[model samples]
Target: MAGLVDALGPILELMTWVGFVPGVPLLVWGLIIARRRCVWTRTTGEVYSAGGFTGFRWTDQDNVQRQTLVDADVARGLVAGNEVELHYDLCHPARWALGRPKHDNTVLILGWILTSVGILCTVGGFVLLLF
Candidate 1:
């Protein structure tokens, strides 16, 4: 058991790099995008269902019609021509989402967890090296 543990020490230390390298960047990018999404334009749209898929359609400020598929949760209880709320980027009308845009914490949480693990591993590695 001790021999196996000793053999894996260096490998575990190197694996920490895998988490640190991507975690910080993911957290930063998630924050930036979440912040930007907070300012998207809000409007009322209509839901539509076709063939086994559900989506919504709305007109942009330019009066151009736009449509995109929605997730099951968003499509629940909705039917064709049902009115729904939507959020969209003013600069890119095609970029839209159901409901008001808010900070999606999924990426942020994952990034934080990975980064914390990496930091702990690094600190422990250094402590072990010194002692």
Candidate 2:
């Protein structure tokens, strides 16, 4: 029992780092996505094609007409001439999102939760090791 307990310590210690590994990167990626989508301009776009590569057209703030291609999932169940709500970047009108940006995104939320767990685990592990 004593030997087994000693062996488990190192394994448990290593596990404390698990959250930080994926958590940090995911948090950073989520922040980048949020930053890029910070100033999105919302508008209605008309679907021109609902085939494999969905195509839609919208007019930007400049009043110039523009068309772009997206995945079929973005315009699912929509046919040609159907109007869809979209969000476009202010600086880069060509870049867009299917709808409003979600405030609680999976990556960001998961990353934050995991990072908090990692911090608690690491601190608890150190305290145990020291004692």
Best by lDDT: 1
lDDT tens readout by residue for model 2, 33-98? 777655777999998864456688999889999899877566577788889898888788887888
lDDT of each candidate versus the true structure: 0.79, 0.78
Residue pairs of candidate 1 with colliding backbone atoms: none
Q: What is the lDDT of candidate 1?
A: 0.79
Model 1 regions more than 4 Å off: 1-5, 39-103
Question: Native-vs-model 2 lDDT?
Answer: 0.78
lDDT of 1 by residue, 1-131 (tens): 66766766786697689779888988897787667653578889988888989998888888888988888886778888878888898877777876566656788888888788788878777766644
lDDT, candidate 1, at 116:
85
